[model samples]
Target: MAVYTHVPAEVLDALLTRYAVGTLVSAKGIAEGVENSNYLVETTKGRFILTLYEKRVAAADLPFFMALLDHLSAAGCPVPRAIPARDGTQIQTVAGRPACLIEFLSGVSPTTPTAAQAGAAGAALARMHLALADFTGARPNSLGIAGWHQLAANCGDALDRIAPGLGGRVADELAWLDAHWPAALPQSVIHADLFPDNVLMLGDAVTGVIDFYFACTEVRAWDLAVAHAAWCFDPGGTRFDPALSAAMIGGYEAALPLSDAERAALPALARGACLRFLLTRAWDWLNTPADALVTRKDPLAFLNRLDAYAGGGLL
Candidate 1:
């Protein structure tokens, strides 16, 4: 989560009193993600995270996110659990926004992940998928193909400001995705967003995963595609280290046996994943105002990534 909405001291204090987390020692705003406002809250009892929902996250969508966290954490997924208030409600209103207190999970996210680290992350993801297998909750992937089209429409020639020929390239990719995006595959509550930043690692092992806001029910292979795109790529997204990619896939396969169809679909699914990020990152790069608390990630990285996976077979 990011710091879009500023939390005044009094407001944070008022919100903190509702929980048994104890006296607030200090609260610091986090500047990592771009969706919600986050603060690393430290209290006498322990460390916890305080999040205030921002504009992009709909109020109705919070329940699914909260419940998913509850379910996954209960099922032993290494995810942070949201602590309900004294009244037993996990969600509370504060600073004119929906907010919640969550248990803090410790582990640094790897910048350039090793093959073994990628494998650990992948295995953790497989376990998470299994954990939520029986969850009846379903949320449509808003950033699916349709969302890609809308983002592209909004981008409209503005992409050239970042890089010439970028707009046309986006159009071509969107067309290809729409025509060939898979419809039927094993579907489940996939973590639609599984970037490296969402994973926590202690030394070589993944401690837990954070940020379930983008989690949704979708093709299971789609989750692998998302993880492959995130972990395998170098920082610039220009070079994809295949050994890391293979390790991740190998770890995942060890946990859950992927059918031939799913394995074969990796290339196409990876292509779509690349396109999805390219579209969203392009839109955010163009639209997010300068002086915003968060840094806009370069969309060109994902474009390069799409090109790298053009021939397919990441695993």
Candidate 2:
């Protein structure tokens, strides 16, 4: 989703030679996300995304990510399918990194998604969870509660560098989350990261969902909690709009009704979701090089959300 490694023309061509995706016309670096090296490559066959796994995206986990996409596509999710090479391999080595070619999905990510779009995003997510219920694989959520401490420790006191009391507040919040996080709530293969940019919209409908690198086995309703944090928060991350939150949850409930326990546990789960992003963003903000070809999302935005959630600004 970001461009840390540049793909030289010959490197790309040599890889494409093994596939029938045709001659590479152009490969433009996608400059949106902070995870991996992504390019919008146009070829004689069609357009596709070439992702070179970068930091944090382990080479061992590549099979899980690829297989999940294949599974979701087979189950009729509106996600791009992995394109295998002529020799029947789905992944290839490129730029000395694990690489794969995925069909380019149509539509654009909405900059300011509407309420209807939020609803559709929820519905689409519900459908995906239902379809993935049969998947037998298990991948631990590296960003789940068990992983938060290391991330905060990785940030160390640098979190306080972002703000005077940010480190102490993050520590306190993580401890509370570790103790009170929900235990049982209809678990399934949940899309742990469903931020707006990861969804492609054609009008109010979701044409595709990308970036399954963060997907893992977790509480089913936790997906909705992640969506609420992503879609309902304001740009400044200063406020959480109840109307937007309601529409999103309402949309999900339409497909799968929330249990009484799930309903009672949602606010805390949402607060946890916000903390996951807040810490990760804060870590990336401090570590990534400024001249890198990617946008480092503002960790302060989530800091504001942490304050909002702590102060009962989010319902």
Candidate 3:
């Protein structure tokens, strides 16, 4: 099972009472994620995920994350609905960190998604973006250009060893981005981390999408680009499945057609998307605390992706 942090039986009992979620039958840490502490809570009422937002998640942005989930749930999207506390607030403090409970979305994240599965995920993401088009709030990008640079700074010493010329190449790429990154595009709420691990599936259908801690307001196309980086390429990144990529993009376009400008900028956005993951993984691999039980994801996986995008003639 997963190792949870500092959760006492009394605190679990208190949460059960506050939410009227019946008796807490069991509670254990969820093992898949690396960022936050999650517990799978089984109550007489049902199963729920109790999240202890780590320091990486900004407290100020908690409202946006909760509100977005509530909004998406109302829109018929298969996202977890945040359960309110006894005080009727969607958020509360637990273990001195922002915490909330969400109805557990049943289904496992696909280990290897088929082409049709990728299409469905893309369609669902498009529908989500459309649903949140009119949402009247904003949250700073947790993994935006600035965050990317900060991560790069932290991992500067390791880049040369991880991938030749990666350090200088990324520096140049950032310089170019500073001059040319999109000032404006179709803005909406986006699931900035739409990786396969966060998309849960049951049989041939997608049951739900989880982990909205990276949600933010940005060019909607950037979300698509991120999804592309995750879904379109394999780990080594040499193999390109055009059919899968096309299916996903096709599904998305069917829901909300991409504008000419959005299409034009997608390639560059995909490059940025590639670099974003590469830098984060590199930093995490180099700096992960020795005591942390989480395994650092491979930075080379994303570097190979960058090489692929460069070779594929970007979009």
Candidate 4:
């Protein structure tokens, strides 16, 4: 059974009443993410995902995330479309947390995604990026440099236990990033976390993407690098899938070709992406409160990725 932050039936009923959707038949937690509390809500009309924004997501940024989905969906992107409330608001306060209902995308995340499937994911992501090219809204990078620093500070005490020298490594990486980070890359809305878990597929075809909580405005190449980290690395981290990376890049380049500078910086950007996930996973492992209903992701999985990038050379 999955851990669920219980929502009383009465409150759920009231929430449903505020929407055009029918009465809720049942609700259960969707146990895949570490950030927000998600529930699979079945209504007489259809199934939907009820997301209760957690601490990591700022309330102010909810509009951008929601609007981005709407924009993307309008432009034929395979992302969940927000179900507007009777009051026409895309988001609402529920149980003291900002909450909203989204049309549940039908598909499962491929556990062992093939190169073709990865290529499809890359294509879908590129389409999403192009669709939102004209979007002018601004949202902070939730998992960018600033958040990395804060996470390290919060989990400073646990570094020795989780991973030795992680603290110093984080400091050094931060310094290196501050000095060498691209200042004039092509900026756009990026789905900062494009991991396999966030992508859904039906058979070999890509279906939809979820977990836009980390979406923000940033370098497009950084987004590509993050996708590479997720698609290229196996769980054990000993294996490398060059074909998968190539397929993904091929699909993306088909939609939006990378600039020479973007390609040049991809190696370092991939390294930075690796470290970002490593630090967050470590912090979550150590600092997730005992009573919190969240699973701690493996920090070593990302550490292994960092190691691979070090030797594999990001060409």
- On TM-score, the stronger of 1 and 3 is 1
Candidate 1 lDDT tens digits, 11-130: 878888888889888999998877888999888899999988888778898889888988998998889988988889998887789988998998999988999999998899899988
lDDT (tens digit, per residue) of candidate 2 on 191-290? 8899999899999989999998888889888888888888888877976677778788888889878889998888788888889998899988998987
TM value for model 1: 0.97
lDDT of 3 by residue, 1-315 (tens): 123356887898887788878889898776665678788889999999888888678888888888898888899999998898777887877877788888898888777677888898999999999889877878878688898888888788689887788899889878877776775887777999999888989875789999988898888899999998898887666677787789889989999899999988887788788889988878767766776657678888887787777565647
Q: Which 10 consecutive residues of model 4 have the lowest summed lDDT?
A: 1-10
RMSD (Å) of each candidate, 1 decimal: 1.1, 1.2, 2.0, 1.8
Q: CA lDDT of 9 in candidate 1?
A: 81
Clashing pairs in 1: none
**Ranked by TM-score, top first:** 1, 2, 4, 3
Model 3 residue 11 lDDT score: 90
**TM-score, one value per model:** 0.97, 0.97, 0.93, 0.94
In candidate 4, position 171 carries an lDDT of 79
Q: Write the per-residue lDDT of candidate 4 for residues 1-315, one digit (tens) a residue.
A: 123366777888999999999999998876675788788889999999888887777888888888888888888888997799888988987787888888888898987779898889888888888887888777867678787788778887677687787778777777877777785889898998999889999987888887888888898889989999888878755677888889889988888888999988887788789888988888768767787666678887877877677664655
Q: Return model 1's CA RMSD, one decimal.
A: 1.1
Give the CA lDDT, 0 to 100, for residue 185 in model 3. Answer: 81
Candidate 2, lDDT over the whole model: 0.87
Which residue runs of candidate 4 sit more than 4 Å off their true CA positions?
1-4
